[model samples]
Target: MAKRRITQETFDDAVRENMEEFEMNPEDALRDAVEQFESQGVDLTCIVKAVPAVSSDDKQEEQTHEVLKALDSLRIGKDSAAVADVTADMKCFTEQCSVGFAQRYLAAQKDAYPTILSYCKKSVEEQDSVLTALSALAALTDGQPDLLDAEGQQFLLDVLKKHQADSSVTCVAICVVRHCCLKHEQNRQDLVKGGLLPLLTRAITQHSGCAELIKQASSALRVMTFDDDVRVTFGNAHEHAKMIVLEHNGLKILIDSATAHPNNTSVLSELCATLARLAVRNEFCQDICDLGGLKLIMTLLADSYESAVVYNNNNKELVRQVLSAIRAIAGNDDVKDAVVSAGGVELIVIAMNRHMTNPTVCEQGCACLSVLALRKPNNCKAIMENGGAFAAVQAMKAHSDAINVQKQACMLLRNLVARMHNYSQPILEMGAEVLIAQAVQTHQDCGDVGKAALRDLGCQVELRELWTGKHGSLAN
Candidate 1:
């Protein structure tokens, strides 16, 4: 049976009922409410699950929650508010918004978007309040991308332009840009046109030593390359990505940044992911190689293997990002040979084996091998000899529910035998056919690629004919 669900208000009311009517304490009430809901198979992950605390007052004034109180403190009845007042109000709103999604949502419902945006506009001329205002705006738009409209986009770009030299301000400003452009296509395009790319790349170059600033700027640059807005038919993601690489010299900047911060896993991971996003063309792929990106990536991948015994989340994420970078840069035919020669194939197999439980790592590992095996018979030989094929099949078996893993495994198996048909029997011996068939049956997105893999492996595939007759006969 499907699990039941409840709204945050309903769950909070139940907790409040236990506390008020039954004379239970807050902790006991919350615990009882949780136990009761979960016992009935209700999901409470979205519920705040905490009793709202009201502010104390000397008089008999109405009680208000923390977020509401913080929001109310921002409405000063003056054209030119004091700097201290503005700073204090901004800090309070930022603190409340940073607590959780519930606070941010409540503030948004109370029309916090325009209120905070007004402060952003007002702070444009007041450099003293730039950081705090930008920080508050960043927090307010964390999961609320729709709050960013044309005016907010202009404000963010203005902040980036004004505070380009100040790493502290640029860091928070770029964070705001990242939040706004995350899933908003128009905002991304407008900001990019407003010269956000140059500011972001410049921030990285000027603040190479500042790990936090570099990480935030790198993430913002990557956000520009995303095509995530679902309402539009197409976005300028490819154009933005190429602009970052070609016009802004993004490849060399990121590579140099990674070289500078070799020991910082988080910064390196962001740099690597951004590099993967910017490698849109064949020459760009080669540019990464010529800029010494391959050696840097290989070194990072090797270093990650050393910490395999005490594998943690950061290590897992770093490995995933590095492998994705390798997969993306290997799109070039010459780079494919280079990767195989540099022991990349073996390292990928080991990464898959080490982080076997992580579906994302497995997905990237299989995808890296798939790219390496494309049209290169010698690389295919290297993969199978180094247990790449076996590891991919194992990843498929282990992460059967991961559609990306299944798809990449099928692509890798097909790429293995596409040029070197002799490798088909060996791969099929590892049960590739069964997994591909299962993927085809389970995931609708995996139908074409999975069946192609099976067909190449000499397994029977029932090719369906959805229509017959001339090409444009349906129009008639």
Candidate 2:
């Protein structure tokens, strides 16, 4: 990526080198750096103030400091009269008038947070001015969400709810809430209580045409779904990404978004992830199947795999979620038949080969095959015909270090061999026994893998014995 035109004051020269070294763009690098700094209690507000005076190398040293507090503060020139004028006429929030005053007040005035929240409430109708205030609030409170007291957090959420119609205002509002909720447990709780999830989902569905707005809303929804409670809530609505999203027919909205913006890979990738998360529960399986979930996900799977090797704009994230969601959906008997009939098993094996080195996809692919293999009497035969058994064993051998792959590989083979048919020959040709023995030895610490590996070996041995008993064994 080319260099982003950051203001010289806010831009660190060495950050460019760090970006190259980390193989990330400017935005991701800065976000990561800020997160690392925040974790160590570093007062970024002070660092921003001290950047001009400090050397780059010395500043680099400061990044690793064990202790950081607001020991330095930005100097301010705003008088009380200017602040009073802005308070009286909300339009004065332009340029540095509002931003500068906010910086000064945050640094010097103890009552800065309360006063700013009240000021924002005054001109909430001024979308542009409210955005400016939110920006200032983010700068002041990114490293310390506590500064955005209960009232401030509520005000920010309210800002999002009120301006859901105005994409620009809601975009900034979403950014403000995301910043506040960055690693702040209390703030996330406040958001959940403030009805952030449903409101954001509504905004996403209502504003599907607005790319930037959908991007921000989906990003925030993804962040909030990190909580287990939130995941369960999302899993409740049949096929909906989250519980809150279902309130506005979020699933249909997702399908509509996918249909309308087929080329928007970013939004689609995020949507895939949300779907994967919601597919965790068994109740959601039939709903997803009925809604053409298998067919939709299969398209993404093929596209992600083909795009990964051939295109620069491949969405690996979409691949990961497609695999995971398939694993969840395939767990159900009905969805399993639907997936197999749609040639989903073959696509899964292809994806595993395509992303052999991707541990996440490899693991999920093996698990999905296991579900497919055990789905019905015909499934094992179908998997063997599609060469899924060999593909699974190959994945296990290739990604031996991935415990999940090992466990799921053992599972798929076990399910296939339970029928004790043509699966054994293909599996053994792929040296399934050797890999299972290795898993048993290598993953002794991982009880699930080791135990499954042992059980599979026993099943294969019994199968060989039965084959020999049925027909005279000829070494030839």
Candidate 3:
């Protein structure tokens, strides 16, 4: 007889003839066939055609058939090494397929998930790559979101707690727990009660080599600790922010990091800004001030070249963040004086001049200047004497075009004139009367500054005469 072609008929005949021998281990039999096909360069189309068709009564077999079909579609050619290359892709595809099957199977069988979970636990130990097994398990949990019944959830929690220290597993486990927590408030409480917080804290401290993992864990911890329910569960965890600031000497770290790696400007800026906001509370400001946060902020302002390049394209946010931090620090008199002594005023003035066309920065700079002026009346007077008042009044007069900038600049001017009526003298002397008269003329509907200018005019003897022009006519 002619040598039999290794078609589906021959393959099925060969399996049937040895059915009793391999009936106890069909998976092993399939693996052997797949390996043989690899070693002998057998035709997969014939082998695939030979595999017995799954019956409708066997849903698991049906899913396996679908998975095999998916695997076949990914086949590049009849090559064997192609099998190994497709392993990861096949695993991912089957993992997703199993999730939908598991959900439907659980609902149909009523207790299928727990049974499969138990089998998974027993077999996971013998698996060559536990990561793959764990990934499948995580997928099951995600798919049958409700499948982690109390016992199943406890089983998962136990696994997580047992391997919580395993850096490789911790990241995956944290992700699984994060997903679970997001599903419900009760799940969040369960995670905290199950000791996820301490696990995350330890991971952050121990996984120093894994920057991405540490960042993710830190982000998760931030979310959990700030969660309304978790907050009450882990009472006063927010207070730990202050402790981190103090213990880490976060200000110095931020300044050094930002200075050293200007590319990481946003990270450092956010850190400094967050610390500054936290420090604004009465209990923390003094400690922040004592920790040299004020000095660091002033240093940032003084060393403009360092931050300037990073902020050249987007100075508005950078300036606002820095100014906010400075303002927080400047709420302390000693810090304000330190800022001025560190040349903060001049740097701010330069930035203001550079960003004059950028109304938001102009407004922020004007506001900072206003703060400095309020803090140092002599500084306010000197600013007017040195032509700072003209720039401010010009910005204020142009408020109609950019209302926010105009409003801030006007408020600054109003504040300056209120603090030191003498400051208005130089402003009025520099044709501020013309600007104010024009603002009154153009923005008769302007509320705050319109009223403020009227009030300032009522206070100024020369401006009052200038407005009346010595004969009760508007200033020329």
lDDT of 1 by residue, 348-409 (tens): 99999999999999999999999999989999999999999999999989999999999999
Ranking by TM-score: 1, 2, 3
Which runs of model 3 end up more than 4 angstroms from their true locations? 1-263, 305-311, 314-316, 382-388, 394-403, 429-450, 453-476
Model 1, residue 198: displacement in angstroms?
A: 0.9
**Top lDDT model:** 1
Model 2 C-alpha lDDT per residue in residues 218-327, reported as the tens digit of each score: 66665564543332343222322446444555555555666656667777776766666566566666667777667788888777756556533346556777888788
Candidate 1 runs further than 4 Å off: 1-49, 57-60, 77-80, 86-89, 121-128, 470-476
Evaluate all candidate structures by whole-model CA lDDT and list the values in order: 0.87, 0.63, 0.54
* lDDT-best of 1 and 2: 1
lDDT of 1 at 215: 96
Which is better, 1 or 3, measured by TM-score?
A: 1
lDDT by residue (tens digit), candidate 3, 145-251 = 44555665575566656665577666665655554554345565565566555666566555645544554454444444334443244443355344344544433
- TM-score of every model? 0.88, 0.67, 0.48
Model 1 worst lDDT window (10 residues): 75-84
